[model samples]
Target: MLLTKVVALSLSFASVWAAPSPPPQSSEVLEVENAFTASKTAPKFKSLKASAAIEVYWHVVSKNSSVAGGNILDSQIAAQITILNEAYSTTGLSFSLAGVDRVVNATWFNKVTDGTREQTEMKRALRKGGAYDLNVYSSGFVEDPRRLLGYATWPWDYAANPQNDGVVIHSGTVPGGDNAPYNLGHTLTHEAGHWVGLLHTFQGGCNGAGDQVADTPPEARPAFGCEVGRDTCTADRLPDPVHNFMDYSDDSCMTEFTAGQAARLTAAIATYRTQ
Candidate 1:
C-alpha cells in the first residue's frame, strides 16, 4: 500500500503547438484562476497504466566531487528512488532497479590527466548493458537513472537527455546539501518530468511552447531569482506557474501536476514501458 499526498504533482505541456518556438517575456501580475485553466480536452492515461514494471539498473559512475565515500551518490539515488516509487504507486505500477549495478570508479581520474577513451568506453558499456536489459524483457521504456554519459550533475538544471532515456543526477546539487545539490528533489521531479516526456514551461530559451502541454502556462523563463513574484509570460492577465515542479523553482516550494500532464505521462509509460 502507498500513501497518497493531498497535493497532486503539477505536470503539464502544450497540446496545440507542434513546433518548438521561443517564449515571450512579460512583467504582468498573474492570478491563480488564470494561471490554472481546465483543458477543453484531456489526454488519456491508459498508456501510462499499461506501462510494464520498470526495473532500473543504475551504473554508478564517479566524478570529481568534494564529498568522500559513496554517501553522496547513495543519498542522491535514495532521493530519486523515493520520488519514482511515489509516482509508480499512484499509477498502480511496480518500479525497481538493481542497486548501482555498475561503477565508473574514476573518482581520481582527472579529465586532463586521463585520456577520454577509457571514460568514453565506460559510458558505452553502461548504455550497452542498459539496452540489453531493455531487449531482455522487450520493455517499451528503458531508463538509466544515474548521471552517466554527459548530463547535468548539479541540482539547478533538471534536464534529461531524451535521446538515451537516461537520467543524470549530482548528489551535491540536491537541496539541503552544501552548494552543489541545491533544490535537488525538485530537480529530480523536473527531470523525471522529462523522463516521462514533460518539457520546461518556458520551453527552450523562453520563446516557444517549452513542453507543448496545454494545461501548463508558457513562460519566458523560470522565476525565483527575485524574492517578489514576477510573471514572464502572461496570455491574458494571469502569471505563469513558475513554482510548478516542471519549472526550475526551489525544491521545497515546487509542487502540483495538472490532470492533463498526469494523463500524458500515464499514457507515455504505458505505450513505451509496457512489457
Candidate 2:
C-alpha cells in the first residue's frame, strides 16, 4: 500500500514523485506464506504449472472524457499488460486481458481511497471473477492525501474480503502518462506482487526472515532512486535489492524478481489462488 508522496527538489518528471512507503505486512500474513512455503511438497499441494494463465478483469473508472481525470486509452492498458507479462516472465505466470469495462462515475473515479466506504462500494459493484482472476481498477486518487500509486489485497485475504480482493491503481500511472518514474506501468507490477502474496523485499528490515526470501538481501528501508551498489543492511554483506519489483524503487530502477520470489509466487498461487 502506498503511504505518502514525497516531493523531491528536482523538477524533472522522473524525480517529481518519490518512492512510496512499503506496504504493511502482518504476522498472520507472514505465517500463512511461511506455511505455504513449508508445505510445497505436502500431499495436498501441487506446483503451479508452467505459464499459469491468469485472467485479468480491467475496470476503468473515469470522471469524464478527460484523460487527466482518469480516462485512459485502451492502447495504454494493452501496454500495461505487456509490461506485466515481461516483468513476471520468469515466474511461470502469464496474464491475459480477459475483460475490460469502462465506467464514467464521478464518485468512484475521484473518491475511492483504499479501505474507505467508497472503495468498498465501488469494488462490490464492479469486482468480477474468482480467486484466480485478477481484477484491476484504474482511477484517480484525488480524495487520498497520500496520492497512492496503487494497492492490492493478498491472495489469502480473498476469502474474508472477497469484494476487495483485487488491485487498484492511479490512472495516470499507466504507460505514456503523467505520473513519471511510475508512469512506466510498474506500479501495477509492484501491487500485483502483493496480490500474489509476495511481501516487500524490505519487509521486516534486517531483523527476521526478510520477505521470507533468501536470495533478496534484507533492506533497512525502501530504495528511492536508482542507487547502484546500495547496501543498507550490511550485516549480511549483501546489497539491498533496489532493482527488485517488490521494492519501492522507481519504475526505471525496478527490473526483475528473484528466483526465490518466483518459487514463492508459484507456491502461493498453488496454495491460495488455485482454489
Q: List per-prediction Cα lDDT, in the order shown.
A: 0.39, 0.76
- Report the number of the highest-TM-score candidate: 2
Q: What is the lDDT of residue 25 in candidate 1?
A: 22
Model 1, span 127-208: residue lDDT tens: 4333212200000011222121112111111122222334444333343443332334444455455545454565533444
Error of 2 at 260 (Å): 0.2
RMSD (CA, Å), candidate 2 to true, equals: 5.9
Model 2 TM: 0.88
Candidate 2, residues 157-199: lDDT per residue as tens digits?
Answer: 6666677788888898899989887899988888788788677
Model 2: per-residue Cα lDDT at residue 218: 93
Residue 101 lDDT, candidate 1, scale 0-100: 43
Model 1 whole-model lDDT (C-alpha atoms): 0.39
Reference-based lDDT, residue 105, model 2: 93
Please count the clashing residue pairs in each candidate, in the order shown. Answer: 37, 0
